[model samples]
Target: MLDPELVERITARRAELDELEEQLAEQLAEVRAERDELAVAERVLERIARQLAE
Candidate 1:
């Protein structure tokens, strides 16, 4: 059987990892949203450039 203290330490580490994962997921979502917004802006600029070129 695993030592009780070892098991407790493992559980604590797992919780810490879970919290980090949650934080990273939130950050990733924000980055993706910003990327999408930039993509839209890029498209608008491209459209304007095409018209200006004509």
Candidate 2:
């Protein structure tokens, strides 16, 4: 059987990893949202430049 203390430590570490995963997921979502916004801004600029060229 595994030592009780070892098991407890493993459980704590797992919880910590779970929290880190949640934080990383949140950050990834924010990055994706910013990227999408930048893409939209780029498109708008392109359209403006085309209009000005004509």
Candidate 3:
């Protein structure tokens, strides 16, 4: 069994870990949005190229 002080420290550290996880999730969401925008831009460029070729 752990001591009381150690248990308290672990509890506090867990909260910090949770906060960090939330921050990471937000950043991942932003990255995914940017990736989707890039994909749309790529499709537009391809269409323009096909028009020029004809």
* C-alpha TM-scores of all predictions: 0.89, 0.97, 0.87
Q: Residue-wise lDDT of candidate 2 within 1-54, one digit each (tens)?
A: 889999999999999999999999999999999999999999999999999999
lDDT of every predicted structure (CA atoms): 0.99, 1.00, 0.99
Q: Candidate 1 lDDT (Cα, whole model)?
A: 0.99
Tens-place lDDT per residue, model 3, 1-54, is 779999999999999999999999999999999999999999999999999999
Local accuracy of candidate 1 as per-residue lDDT tens digits, 12-53: 999999999999999999999999999999999999999999
Question: Which scores greater on TM-score, model 1 or model 2?
Answer: 2
lDDT of 3 at 27: 100
Worst 10 residues of 1 by lDDT: 1-10
Going through the candidates in order, what is the number of backbone clashes in each? 0, 0, 0
Q: Give the lowest summed-lDDT range of ten residues in model 3.
A: 1-10
Q: Which stretches of candidate 3 lie over 4 Å from their true place?
A: none
RMSD of 3: 1.3
RMSD of each: 1.0, 0.4, 1.3
**Clash pairs for candidate 1:** none
